[model samples]
Every structure is written in C-alpha cells, then in structure tokens.
Target: MENNRYNNFWRRLAPSVGLFFLAPLVGEYLLGNISIKDIWALPFLAPMYGGGALLIREVTRRAGRGWPTLILLGIAYGLLEAGLIDQSLFNPSFEDHVLQDVAYIPALGVSAYNALAFIVGHAVWSIGTPIAIIETLVPARRTTPWLGKVGLLVTAVMYIAGSVFVFRDLQREEQFLASTPQLIVVSTMAVALIGISFAVGRKPQPKIDRQTPNPWIVGTLSFVISSLFFGATENWVGVAFKLLLLALMTAVIIRWSRCQGWGIPHRLALAGGALMTYAWGGFVLTILLGRSETIHLVGNAIFAFGAIVLLIIAARKTHDM
Candidate 1:
C-alpha cells in the first residue's frame, strides 16, 4: 500500500513538474531572450514562470473552468510580471532596450506597443501554450487538479518568493520603481481580469452547428497568424494591426471551439503551430539582437529541433486519443 501510494503521488505530480520547467523553457530560453551560456538562470526563472503557470492551471482546473479562464489568468500573470516584478512595462531603459521610445503614451507612462506585445506574448506563449502542451501530453488529467492543498500552498509561496526576488534585484540594479499611480492602475487591471475570468467561466458554452475546419488547416493558420502577430513592427501601426489580428483570431477560435467537431487534435495543432513559431523565430530574434554567435545559433537549433519532436509526439498522442 505504501509503494502504491508513492507511485500515485508521483503520477499525479508529473504534469505539474512538466509545467514547472516547460514554462520557463518556452517563455525565455526557447524565445532566445536567454542565451545557452546563461542556462544556469533556468532555476531562478522556473520559480516565477513555472510557479505562476502551475498556480494558474491548478486554479482554473479546480474551478471547472476552461481556456478562457486560463488565458485571462495568463494576462494577469503577464501584467504582474511586467508591471510589478520586473517593471519592464514601465521601465523605459529596461536592459537597455529603450522600450518606451516608440508609441509612448505620456499619461500612462508606458509604450502602447510594448504593453500589448508583452502582455499578449505572456498570455498566449508563456502561460497558455505550455499549459496546452502539457495537458495534451497527459489527456487523462487534463481538466483535473494536479496538486493537493499542500502542493498549492508550496506553489503559491514559491511564486511569491520568486517574484519578490526578481522585483528586488531589478529595483536595486536599475534604481527604478513605477509611480504609485502606475502601480495602482496595473493592480486594478489585473484584479478586474481575474474577476472577469471567473464570471466568464460560469457562463455555459454555446454550441455551434457549423463544421470545424481540419486540424491540419487549423495548425497552418495558427502558425501563420502567430508568426505575423510576433513579427509586427514596434510602432503604432503594428500595434493596431496586432489588435486586429487578435480580435479576429479570438472570434474564430471561439466559434470553432463551440462546435461539436472541435477536439484534442485541434487544440494540439493550435499549440503546435504556435510552438513552431517560437522555434524558428528564436533564430531570427538572436540575429536581430546581434547575438548571432555560434553558440547562440547552435542553441537555437537544438531548441527548435526539440520543439518539433515534442510537437510530433504530442500529435501522435492526441491522435491516439
């Protein structure tokens, strides 16, 4: 009985563990923001990215919520990371990026373009994509809560600790803190989003009679759309275009998801497409950052290859389901 119980515990915790590491791997390293030489930072990043992802997933699943709720929570996570932890959204000179130079909104003390990019990037890629991929890999436990009460407490504590560590480190290094009003606005927005997620989740999903598109087509479209979304220039026109694309993608996905034909394959394809985008896009980003070193390129190749393999395995698993 003791052995059996131990096995069950690990079985239940496996997905959580996957998300714990996969979140940071996809969010930072796979995106080429952190080079291979800095792989040591993964442990530091895992607490915030992985812990947040686990917390978001556990809360959404335990509440019997779905993707909409998860995505909303992801946006809230993005807001917290940008506005509070790292203050990148408000820090004009963050890592010498000079983010606020373009599409700067004086009243808000933020760059409108960067705000959209960071928030949406985190929502869709950092949190949402990793959750989708892991859940796809373990379909049996997809909607079930993976962590127990103790686990939840630990995750929360880790997230808080990680966030505070990053916040303090960045504050000391940059000597920057967002204004009180800016902090207040960000906090308010995050709270509102969290509230809205639960409210939206409570509503019954509407069924549509229309036939869903083929999974291959869906995957292709997702790849193209996500590619375009991330490739947008850092300007007002790019911001407007991204917003339009987001609205259209949201509408289409919602409509198709409501249809009876939508299933695990479609979901997997959507995630796979987006995953592929980052796989190749990482190379481009490395080049753009003028870090086209052999090590960086080699790292990008390894990560991109791993992504493709993972997607293939996921596709096969999804088909078996």
Candidate 2:
C-alpha cells in the first residue's frame, strides 16, 4: 500500500516537475537568460510554462494522438506565449530584439521573422523537448493522461492567472501590445491551431517503409542544424537562410520517416538532436554574452552538461526499446 502511494505521488508530480524546469531550461536558460538566478521568478514561471506544457501534453495524449498532434498543440502554446500572454510577437522592441521592420506587416503589426522564430522556438524547445524527454523516460506512460479532469481544470486556471500576471508586468515595461483586433485575430488563430491539431491527431498515421537512421547521426545533425539556426538569429539574413535550411531538413526528415526504417529511436534521436544544440550552445553563449555571474554561469554549464548526458541515455534507451 505504501509503495502504491509513493508511486502515485511521483506519478502525480513528475509531469509538473518535468514541465516546470523544461520551460526555463529550454526557453530561458538554454536560449539565453539565466533566470535561474532569480528565485522569485519560479512561482509565476511555473504556472505559465509548466501549466502550458502539462495541459497540452495531457490534452493531446488523452485524445489518442502522438508527437504530430503534440507539435500542433506546441505551436498553439507558442502562439499563446508570444502573442497573447507576453505579447512579444507584437512588441516592436523586445529584449533588444530588432524585429520591427524585418518583414513587418504594417496592417497586422507582425514581423514575419519574429513570429516564425519565436513560435518555432517555443514549439521545438519549450514544448517539444520536455515532452520527448519525459515520454522517453517512461515510454509506457507516453500515451496516458497524467492529469484528471479536476487536475486539468486547476492547471488551466493557474495558467490563466499566470498569464494575467505576466501581461500586467509586461505592460509596466511598456512592452504590451494593446490592439484588440490583433488580439482577436491571434487568439482566433490560436484556437484554430488547437482545433487543427486535434483534428489531424485523430487520424491514423499511414504505415510506411521505415528507414531508421543511426541515433547518433540523427542527434549530431539535429545539433548542428539547430545550433546554426540559433546562431543565425543574430542577423536577419542568417535567420532567413537558416529558416530555409530548417524547412529543407524538415522536409527531408518527413520524407525519410515515411520509409519503414523509421521507429522510436529515430524519433528520440531527432528530439535529442534539437536539444543537444541548446545544451552545448547554452554554456558557450552564457559565457560569451556575460548574461550571468561567474557562479551562475558555471552552475548553468554543469546543468547543461547533465541534461546532455541524460538526453543521450534517453536516446539509447529509446533506441533499445
């Protein structure tokens, strides 16, 4: 009985924990900011990031879908974060991000580059990475809902409350976009994205001739490509070029996966590859950017290394499975 209770406790808590850390790990720490130094931030961050991931993962899995659906939900989460909650998508100047005129749509007040990068960043790193790692860690539970209806309701409330807090804070910084029409359009699009995800996720994926690649190769390519992509964000030209490369690689992967050789290992490898980019790059950029103190930088580096090791282990386990 005690064992069952302990198991239930961990089961109840692990998903939240995984999601809480993952948001900062991938979104803040790995991407650039070492918000780990700010203990005061976790309360708000936890609800916003953790709740978003948990809700999406549970909803998609409960719907009997897989990564593709999760990816769609991820895109929705991205839109929510960048568009509604933080309004970074519409912010003319966010964090020294000079995206106002980079393919800016005057009517929409949206920058094509910023929208794409932010959305993809949240989709791939913030949402996708954690889900892949957690699912890989416990493959048996991959398809199950981690939260019940009550739990989900609580999570949704927490997420909304967190968003309100963030939106208020952003407004204080004068970074808030107050366009109601834009808000309506983006919110409608977010809803549409979620609907599309559920609709597509309900369909069965077609069987194909799987051509699985070496997990290491997949990880390496993902690392190199994703690293280049992240690095290119420094300039508009690089961003455009890398976006093209990203599209090309994605197309190739999808086509290749249609073959029978594609399996669990390949999927994990692809995830690991994307994650490895941030793992190593996080350390180097943290130092170069001087975003944190020496101690914080060193601590973040250690964590990054640990993450890479764990991801590698997970990749191996996924391959073996």
Candidate 3:
C-alpha cells in the first residue's frame, strides 16, 4: 500500500515538475536571452517563470477551463513581469537595451513594438507553449488538475516570492520605477484581461464543418508565422504588420481548433513549430546583439539541439497516445 501510494504521488507530481523546469528553459535559455554563462541564475528564474506557469496551469485546469483561459493568464503574467516586477515596460534603458527608442509611445511610456512583443511572447512561448508541450507528453492528464490544494498554495507563494525578489533586485540596480498612472493602467489592463479570459472561455467554440489541416501543414504554418513575428523590425510598420498577423492567426487557430479532427498530434505539432522558431531565432538574436562569442554560439546550438530532441520525444509520445 505504501509503495502504491508513493508511485501515485510521483505520477501526479510529474507533469508539474516537467512544466516547472521547461518554462524557464524555453522562455529564457532557448531564446538566448540568457546563455550558458548565465545558467547559474536559473534557480532564481525558475520560481518566477516556472512557478508562475505551474500556478496558471493548476488554476485553469482546476476551474475546468482550457487553453484560452491559460493564454490570457499568461499575458497577465507578462504584464506583471514587465510592468510591475522588472519595470522593463517603462524603462528606457533596460539591460543596456534601448527598449523605448523604437516605436515609442509617449503617453504610455513604452515602446509599442516592444509592448506587443514582450506581452505576446510571454503568453505564447513562456506559458502557453510549455503547458501545451507538457500536457501533450501526459495526455491522460492533459485536462485534469495536477496539484492538490497544498501544492497550489505552495506554487502561488513561490511565484510571489520570486516576483518580489526580481522586483527588489532590479529596483536597486536600475533605480527606476514607473509612474503612478502607468502602474494603474498596467494593473487595470492585466485585471481586465484575466476577467475576459473566463468570460471568453465560458463561450463554446463554434462548430466548423471544414476538415482540420494535416499536422505537418499546421506545424509549418505555425513555424513560418512565429518566425515572422519575431523577425519583424522594431518599427511602426513592423508593429502594424504583426498586429494584423496576430489577428489573422488567432482567427484561423480558433476555427481550426473547433474541428473534430483537431487532436493531440496537431496541438503538439503547432507547439513544436513555434518552439523551433525560438531555437533558430536565438542564433539570430545573438548575432544581432553582437555577442558573437564562441561560447554563446555554442550555447545556442546546444539549446536548439535539445529543443529538437524534445520535439522528437513529444512526437513519439503523441503517436503512442
């Protein structure tokens, strides 16, 4: 009985553990925002990125919600990270990057291009994509809650503590804080998005008579579109184009997902495609940032290879399912 109980506990904990590590790995490391040299900081990053992902997943699943709800919450998490925790949304010089120089919005005190990139990037890559991949790996528990009440509470506390730690550390280093009006606006927008998520999730998906596309096609399109999204220049034209692309992509996905043929393989393919974009995009970013150090290049290659291996595993698991 004790052995059975132990096995069950580990089984239940496995998905959460997968997500806890995968979130930061995909979000930070694979994206080349932090290279091998900075790997030491992962322990610090895991709580905020991984813990937040776990909490968001648990809450959505517990509420009998789905991807729509989780994606919105991911955006909310992005807002809190940029606008509140790191204040990167308002910081003109964050990490020596002139974030506000391009497409600056004076009224909002943020770069329009960056605002879209950071928020949407966090939503899709940092949160939604990792959850999708992990759930695909554990198809049996894809829609089920993985955590008990105590686990949920612990995740929440860890996320909060991580956020506080980042916030204070950045505050001291940057010595910058967003204005009251900016803070209020960001807070309100985040809350509104969260509320809208539940409302939108409650609405049933529209039935589609059309057949879903082949998984390969779906994956290719996802890869191309996501690459375009990240590869766009930091200008008003790029921003406008990305917004249009975002709307179209959202509409198309919503329609495709409603088809009866849409299943685990298709979902996994979509995620895998996006994941690959970051895998390669990391190299481009490194070159652009002029960090052409051999170590950084090698690190990007290693991370990209790891992403490929993970996708292969996910594909095999999906096939078995």
lDDT of 2 by residue, 1-321 (tens): 999999999877786677766765676666555545664576667788777888888888787787778888899889988988888888887755555777777888988777877898888888888777777877777778887789889989988888788888878886557499988988898999988887774655576755666767877787788877777754467658778877887786766566676766766777788877877766776767666577667657666776778777786677566
**After superposition on all CA atoms, how large is the RMSD of candidate 1?**
1.2
What is the TM-score (0 to 1) of candidate 2?
0.88
TM-score of each: 0.97, 0.88, 0.97
lDDT of 2: 0.76
**What TM-score does structure 1 among the candidates reach?**
0.97
For model 1, how does the per-residue alpha-carbon lDDT over 190-228 read when each residue is reduced to its tens digit? 999999999895876888888899999989989999999
State each model's CA lDDT, in order: 0.91, 0.76, 0.91
Please, what's the RMSD in Å of model 3?
A: 1.2
Model 3, 131-215: lDDT tens digits are: 9899988999999988889999999999999999999999889999999999999999999998988887686777678889999
- What is the lDDT, from 0 to 100, of the residue 303 in candidate 1? 86
Clashing pairs in 3: none
Winner on lDDT between 2 and 3 is 3
